[model samples]
Target: MDDQRRIFLATASRLGALAALTSASATGRAQNRDGGHAYPFSLGVASGSPLPDAVIIWTRILHDPLNAAATPRLAFSVRWEMAEDEQFRRIVAKGAASAAPELAHSVHVDVTGLRPDRWYWYRFMLGDAVSPVGRTRTVPAASGMPKQLKLAVASCQHWEFGTYAAHRHIAAAAPDLVAFLGDYIYEWGPYQLRHPKSAVRASESFTLADYRARYAQYKTDANLQAAHHAAPWIVTWDDHEVANDYGNEQDERLDPRFLQRRAAAYQAFYEHMPLRLTPRDFAHLRIYQRYDWGKLARFHVLDDRQYRADLACPPPGRGGSNSVQPRTCPALTDLGRGMLGREQEQWLAQGLSSSPARWNILAQQTLMAQNSQLPVVKEGDGRFWTDGWDGYPAARRKLMDTLHTSRASNPLVLSGDVHSFFACELARNPSRPASPDNPLLATEFCGTSITSPSRPQTRTEQYVSMNHGIKYGRSDKRGYMLLTITPSDTSAHFLVLDNVHDDASPIARAAAFVVRDGRAGPVRA
Candidate 1:
């Protein structure tokens, strides 16, 4: 069905849900054989893609969220209410959204006509049962400059590896926004050599139902649920959303059924997340949108996986992957090949150039800096992993060039998927370090994964040694970063967990850095 008809039906059902709030007859449609208990809100509630005037509130209804029989063919009417006060005494908006079975009983309420730069409390109701109360805030007015914004950066939470203790901490800290840079769910199935053995699933996620089951498993975690309930999220996908290291039309496995798998995965992603726009097609999702937090920040959310060029080098006798030296492979310098694609690149440039926010943040997936691992024999040359920005040199250079000329005040790039923290000064040329003549144009803060295993600490040190512009890095611990942005300065605290294997592990600060408002690079603070 089209969106307008679904929305209209949903709005009309609000009165029905309200009238049935005290009745068991209407709510019986939501019940399943789970020993006479309601579990429709198992996945919890979430809000995302916040704007000054509107925000998206979402929830899925299922008695058995982890299995396909949980959601039947019939639709369930759901009532949602928003209030300015936590007590819900001050009601701002009230509406009904139908949990359509076709959409996996997922409700996406694009709430409009709300105040800006303020906190709002909301909840969902079915019959007499109410969901957990969630807190979400809209952005400040476009022309106004807000005092501060506390944002939590997170990504790459592989379920089987560890528990989501980091998300629990994020919920308690209560940032204004959460930026998930992708790898929300890993595509690989259960593995034998993983910690916290409780999280392993039985099979890989290929079909739409399989993907939905995977998401349900992850969302079932109490800690991850708490974080979603705490604040609105701005999410973008990486390679794992569809397949492992899949680029453009190519999957790492190079299976003939990759396209169908991608379509199923995309549909499942849309059904699960709190997004404003629906996908136009299976492989085509307009997730690369923009957001503004008053005049203080403008976030350019980017999609780097769908339209990116395939990996540059397929090492001899194997599939398309691994690293390659620039001197040996001349194709590494192809300016025509891209990471963000041509259209996204243009859109990003235009947005960055025209934005009035004090901090122009490029929130994207994967590393943007050149992390070279060139052999000693090729000392002066650069070679890098074909999976990140290093694979698309020309595109990275163009992005740097755009940042240098943009009218935006402070250009900050937030990245994830590397499973390590990297604080670096973005240079137009990575072969040379930042100098007085070649000034640094932007700063990048790459957050570590919440539960995903980190690379060797030695590898992080190696990257730092190879790239002089990189100021600080650590891969020994797993946690998220809390970014506090003010008009005068923006600072990041790397919050690390003592032991992810232990759910009760204590969290401590690993490192901290600040970038002064006008400065183009990060300074140890």
Candidate 2:
């Protein structure tokens, strides 16, 4: 057997053993195609960008995802079906989707006219070969009220770091919605701890083809495939999706050719994702939009990287991750600088004011609460990470003011960029202390990465010490967050694995917090 085949079989065996741990059945079971061993659906399938009436079903027809040596330059006719039953007894929607080569033969079936708040199973077929069955569901009607909502927040699954044990856990949880807040695919080439039989490109991804190859490599993992096939997802990109710590049109490496690279990356991202909207131009790719789960919650998805001003503290082209005092950096306090741009900020403000849901959620890419990295003893005075909301103080203040003024109830923020779990309270007055007049404005739950390595453990003294708003924080292990929302309360559980390197790693809940109706902060539960 070829080395790649051997490695794939070994990983498949490990995943099969771990499959017993999950309650939900796994997807992406390989099928024999033709007399010859032709693997057409190698990347598996995904469904995302859901709505009350519409949901997208996606699959890429790739005979060779990792090695695109020879281009067939031919389009394939792919048939798709949506069923009300897992056994495919009653079919709801069935149609033929063309997998065009121009778009990498990726089929995105925008299934519409479906009933709200309903579950359905979907799958694809090419010739006599059948793809894995994927499960999907539509959100509740805009004016309707859902009694309960289960959302799994995940991010930063670096392929080289470890296996996607966390994603396996997410699939088993079977959340109604999965929110992926960026770093969906790492642009850099594979490094230490590359999985066995895993194909790693030698050079970093830059061109459209290079980025496509990287995505294919990551999608080959059965565990990740299971997670994607298990539920419908809402996705947004972070820095690693294009370039590390890239701001607006600026690249961290200070490369003049970065915009070309950015364009290619954006195109590839759109092609691979199950997005309803296609990119008109690489410079104008839009992913920020809103979704409502009936009257239960209104999710305002924001893009913080696309049209934002550059980093503040060290300034552009300085190549630093250190924090700075507000006095030291004049630009850090600039009110004109923005993270979500003016247009998106206005849209968010309008959404918050006009939202009719019981819970208002800001589902975005990065942390919104101010987090101090300084010593615990220096409580009120310290430096902070420039990459997060702390660098855009004025912008964050504007959001806080909007949330405080809006009529939206149980305002909450879900974030997943820092690769650390944080349960924090957004203060009404960000620049000042929290008091009765300026008390906790909203609750923020920042989930850790799906498989990304944890940051260096901070001193125990830092927990709930330096930052008055930080109710809990942990950077020791890799995991995801499970959020259960209802009319009366919203609860968040931090789920972690004992070891990600082991496919059968045990899953455990490290901590959990609850925010009751009318409460503005998270209380330990």
TM-score of 1: 0.90
Least accurate 10 contiguous residues by lDDT in model 1: 18-27
Candidate with the greatest lDDT versus the true structure: 1
* Candidate 2 lDDT tens digits, 1-525: 963354334334445643432212112233345544345677778898889888999998876655654336688889999998767999999999988877878888899989888888888988877777777899998888788999999999888677888887777777888999999999876632235344455568888888888887777676787778777988889888888788887776767787888888988888888888865787678888888899999999889988888887555555424478765777777889899988898888899899999999988888887776664343245676777888788888888888878867889999988888989889855544578887888999999887776666665237447677777888888889999999999999999989877776878999999999998888899
Q: What lDDT does the true structure give each of the candidates?
A: 0.81, 0.80
Model 1 superposed RMSD (Cα): 7.4
lDDT of 1 by residue, 66-117 (tens): 4658456788899999998767999999999998877888899998998888
Model 1: CA > 4 A from native: 1-37, 191-195, 198-202, 316-320, 375-380
Task: Report clashes for each candidate as comma-separated counts.
Answer: 0, 0
**Candidate 2, position 7, lDDT:** 31
